[model samples]
Target chain A: MTVSTLPAYPARSARLKRISAEYPHALGLLLLAPMLSWIAVFFIFPTAWMIWQSFSERGLQPYATILTSAIYLKVLLTTLKICVITTVGCLILGYPVAYVLTTARPSTRAVLLILVVLPYWLDFIVRSYSWMILLGRHGLINQLVTGLGISSTSLPLLYNLFSVSIGMIQILLPLTILTLFSTMVRIDRRLVDAATIHGASPWRAFRTVFLPLSLPGVYAACLLLFVSALGFYVTPALLGGPEQTMISQTIMVIASDLLDWPLASAAGVLLLVVTTSLLVLYSRFFRLDRMLGGMAR
Target chain B: MRAPRASLAVNGLAGAVLVFLLFPVLVVVLISFSSVDFLSFPPPSLSLRWYRTIFSNFEWINAFLLTLQVGALTALLSTLLGVPAAFALSRHVKRGQNVVNALVLAALVTPPIIKAISIYLYYVPFGLLNTVPGLAFAHTVSGIPFVVINVVAGLRGYDRDLERAASIHGASPLRAVLGITLPLIAPSIIVGAVFAFMQSAQELLIAMFVLGTLEKPLAVKLWEGVRVAIDPSLAAATTSVTVLAILGLVTVMLAGRRARPTRVAVQG
Candidate 1:
């Protein structure tokens, strides 16, 4: 478009030069057109329409229906509950990993850190399927239990909150560890040493010195994890039980199975509001670079 | 020096957590070699029978090929579209820059399910569903943020003097950027490209919505396989994708390592 808009060469070369000199930033603007256009047409337009459709469908009634409906509120509550539980689970599981990463010998820390990052690099679905194999009745855990003669029946490990949580905790565990580890690594080790020298116990040194220092990482991790966990569709949809379906699963059913775009859009708008608010907080205070570079050092 | 006793205990617990994280993948790999028809741990006997099944199956192969095609194109397109936008954000108009930044990275915050549903509703009339180009376009939205982040980092660390020198002497702004700036940030761009590939290749929900009636990609295929039953062949598929993901990540790491030297040179 820029090329075509250029003035015809013979008499207009001066004019073309004048325009280019005057508007140096125009090239940059021209460069952005393809991506901006695509995003506008595909992403922004759809999102705007979705929000509008939620209100326009039956004339501002979808919002009322969703807000008033017990089923919708229950699903929203389940989603929030799951997000809280998953955040807590990640903290408990990830804190030690981050602690070790900051405290271990360099060689040992690198290996330990890589182990966490390695799982994150894998496809979540593939990693999740690993749980699928282990949790099913015909799976190994069951085979072991039955073969050991401890129980006559296979454990109901699949399609439950426990299984879903296990899978998500594993997937989300890396993010928490990486965030907390970055913060923990920055903590001045001498402060903990200073506390130890004053006759405080090791636990006291950690609680009074280290834990408080690393709280930012914990905050960052919790905010990032909770927001991310809220949007989890694949793992919960695949691994969760009928009773354990989260808001995302409900949205999927409404969108595809029920063909209720208004209801689906309403659910989605709710999810978007909650997640975007948390994420805006994250993006405001944190650098994406640090999030990725936890192990780079 | 050896760590304190309590620290050693913490390290041991960390090891166990790592095991918990990696245990499922190891189980999947082991079960893939199961000689029996069903998934049982410590297989009755080891065999390559499942891998053989994937190799023999056309559906599996087609899905793999389509995944590769879509993933590669998504990577390429995201890079082309994203790198320029990154450049713009790095040194362009300051007004409305935050607005543009939010718009570009919007895909990251929005739930994939929401994107999938909204895009599906939007795409039905356009009949863009079930096409590789359609899926790639949807995926590119998610991938652009990686380029913006990585390349913007590169730009932040770069010396603007070189581009400025080129433009002041004789070169146009476009030439200065294309010739002087791009090569300096090429490594970051590559990392962004790899990220784009991984984002698309691992993507499932969006693929599910956009690829109706069309041949499913490996992600959809893998999802269907596991949902129906976790078989040895599904294990093989997961293993293949995992291997590819690891390979991609390792490339980014190596590139990042190489990136340090260039940055040091610029700083010096």
Candidate 2:
């Protein structure tokens, strides 16, 4: 790595410096200013306003209500429980798929990769609705279950936490696989071979040489999955019963339906705080740039 | 060689998961052909009634046309703004670029609801609430980052010495970039544009915040169809959207594959 601490603008050539120095990094700043301003105005400003609104009187009441009431608290707890289960489910299911993808030939790898990403092409609403049809009382699952003599009539498949988790796991599993697969590809194959030559079992070779190196992707995937799960609106709103309410759906109801911007803003602000904190924690333990950039292990 | 049975079991299990993954789409496709009014699986009889209904309905057509307009506009604007920004970020190792990079990541990471709410609040003062331009603007902001990320990945993998050599032969900086750099990075730029188009097509939360009752995107249309009507015709609309999205993706993949690598090649 080049570690030269040359200032961004170096006076290496006096004549060229004389011509450009007056601009004082002006070109780069000029290019960046518009996007920076756009984010500041549209992104940072709204978030700051949301936080401010959260402290106001109306927000405090809902904030008090959410924190004090058992119903809201129960929902919040259930959301977290589901997020953890989904994360673990993705890890279990995704690891082997990721491994197989990485070990495959390049052409095969490319096709498999595309297959994994293809489902995500559909709109989130469409995907959730597709699940709604599949998992409904008289839907495919119940029909198949009855055909196999597993149940008498259609089962109560919709309007439950099970449907919510199944939908999320489907949407999330591909991402986890891709992330972990990229990291695994960067690992040194010789290390595994070296373990094998030293008489380590196949499982031991992976455990000792592979898994530790792959932790960054696992952590990154979990972080992305958790934050994404927290922001979920459409899936739970469609598949979930009244009890499986997530914070995003709650925010929408409060802001749009209930005509309470402050309360909605408060919930949005809380969601942001919780998700951002999880990201910060992940970044602390893992080099997120490496995972996101899909670079070396 | 531990156990053939274990290997069979593992393959069998994976096959089951794959089936589960595909089961929903399969069900929807089947439901779309159902003859019954209420959604019944293993349709008593099959017909194209719902598909015919889709064309006859003004609401579906209007929402679809509006979505097409928004998607096209968002894709165009995102490419215009994002391509140059990605070029600048990738080519430079300037001071405080990391902070700028972090800002983009923050945009990517922030929840859609948060983004929608922010745009809503910001637009209220400018009377931009419930407007197409406002919704398009929100889509553009989010969409640009995808282009930037993809294009920058392309740039990072590029060899920079080729441009320096062209400049040494006395070519102008703009000519060197246009002739040398653009040719090499075309694939990534095309990929970025494709991603931006897909993002614009699927977005709903922004439309929820910015669109008025008069104009709604296809995703918003889908949402309402699920909540309000829950009709059999909704399946036909859903099927069409899926087909449209896949076709758009295939078109991009083909265009990217066909993009000439040397059309913009350097001349000395």
Q: Each prediction's Cα lDDT score?
A: 0.79, 0.72
For all candidates in order, state the fraction of native interface contacts they contain: 0.51, 0.26
Q: TM-score of each candidate?
A: 0.84, 0.87
User: Which numbered prediction scores highest in TM-score against the true structure?
Assistant: 2
lDDT of 1 by residue, B1-268 (tens): 2237887788789889989988876777787788998767768899999989998999999988898889888888888888888777666644556566656646765788989988888898899998999999889888877776778778877888776666455555566577777777777787777778877888888899999756899888887877786468888876777677668767766776677567545532
State the lDDT of candidate 2 residue by residue for A1-297, as single tens digits. 011222232234334445445665654566566667766766787778767777776636867867887876776787788788788887887777777666668887787676676666667777788887778877778889998998888888898988888888887877787778767878988888898789887678778988998887887788878877877788889989987887777778878898777777777777787877776666555432333342111
Q: What DockQ does candidate 1 have relative to the true complex?
A: 0.42
Give me the runs in candidate 2 sitting further than 4 Å from their true place.
A1-28, A56-62, A282-297, B1-16, B29-49, B94-98, B264-268
lDDT of 1 by residue, A49-124 (tens): 8888887867667778888999888888888887888999999999998888887799987877767867755678
**For candidate 2, what is the lDDT?**
0.72
